[model samples]
Target: MTEGTSNDSTSDHLSNNGRSCCNKESTNSNILDAVQTSIDSLANKEWSNVESRVLVVYTGGTIGMVRNNRGALEPKPRDLERRLRGYPHMHDEDLAKEKYPNSPFLVLPLYKEKHCIIYMIHEYSPLLDSSNMTCDNWATIAKDIRSVYKMFDGFVVLQGTDTLAYTASALSFMLENLGKPVVITGSQIPIFETRSDGRDNFVGSIIMAG
Candidate 1:
């Protein structure tokens, strides 16, 4: 009687174990499928097959700032994209055009015959300023670049100069086997101003990144 009772208990435990394992596997599979669907939806755009692809990681800084209701400069989300799109000189559509009579082009300037920059920005939400940067912030920036390192020809880091020196130094060690250019720059003034260092820094970084 005692042996039978022990056996029954073991069997019941194993039965529950099997069910729990199956449930966990099903949950994992569903999560994976959802992730894949999201990735496919986001990356469905056709590529131009540009030789040079630069990834600009806009962490945040003075360059992307504007005066808020408090009358103080603060980083605005997505404002960098708006500013860049509006500034023809910063990203000249004419420059991106190939010499050929009919061809599609963007803002990037063609560097050699085939080394034109086709870049994308990955801006952080609630952009960080140089002063507020921490070790984790540096890690995030380094990891961001590492995640898509192979896909790009170069990288441009738009960050505040206040802590740029330390951040750059940290990245040098964190990023291993770097075979491409990684240009880090920030403007002393806001890009929205008519006469600002932002234009030069931005344009220069793009050219260098390409």
Candidate 2:
């Protein structure tokens, strides 16, 4: 997930089959109770038996951002790991809290949902912004995915909106097999922005990738 959080959002990020199906406050309580309970009666790692595999390739996005005391944006690599470990779906109280703490409906269950594997590959350029995106940069991104293609079931590409569509189209052309999704997304707002679109976009990207 990319790093960015806005306290102003009330949008429900989780749903099924395109229908809105979650409440901001109790979404987590409901989901964990649902998925975990449904799978509870089955053997361990019910997901392992699923027909498809999920590979979370977190490139860079608002979901990965944290704010410094100075109000500057910073990426917290460790927090990402912790959030995933915590499994926001396990319970609403601990993992359900918004990363920004300003938005109620932006809760993420990345901490709860399990992927076949997760990869963290930040942009190559120190100042890589989607606005200045280039073909070479896109190539590097594609190359990274291709390099890891054989190791996972599917791929997710975290990116900036400035060039999200272009990158996605290019990726579709470059990657073969197409056995799984290679979803790409970024927020209209910065992850550090009080009301940024980072969280929803991130959660959505992860869901789509899966």
lDDT values, one for every candidate: 0.62, 0.46
> Taking the tens digit of each residue's C-alpha lDDT, what string does model 1 give over 72-167?
888889777766766776665555443311322235655466555656667776688799887667666655654555566677889998998987
**Pairing residues by index, what is the TM-score of model 1?**
0.69
Predicted candidate 2 versus true structure: per-residue lDDT over 61-104, tens digit per residue: 45556678997765555354445434443224342232222212
State the number of backbone clashes in model 1. Answer: 0
Once superposed on the true structure, which residue ranges of model 1 sit more than 4 Å away at CA? 1-48, 69-71, 93-106, 110-115
Tell me how candidate 1 scores on lDDT. Answer: 0.62
Q: What range of 10 consecutive residues in model 1 has the weakest lDDT sum?
A: 1-10
C-alpha lDDT (0 to 100) for residue 66 of candidate 1: 88
RMSD per model, one decimal:
15.5, 15.8
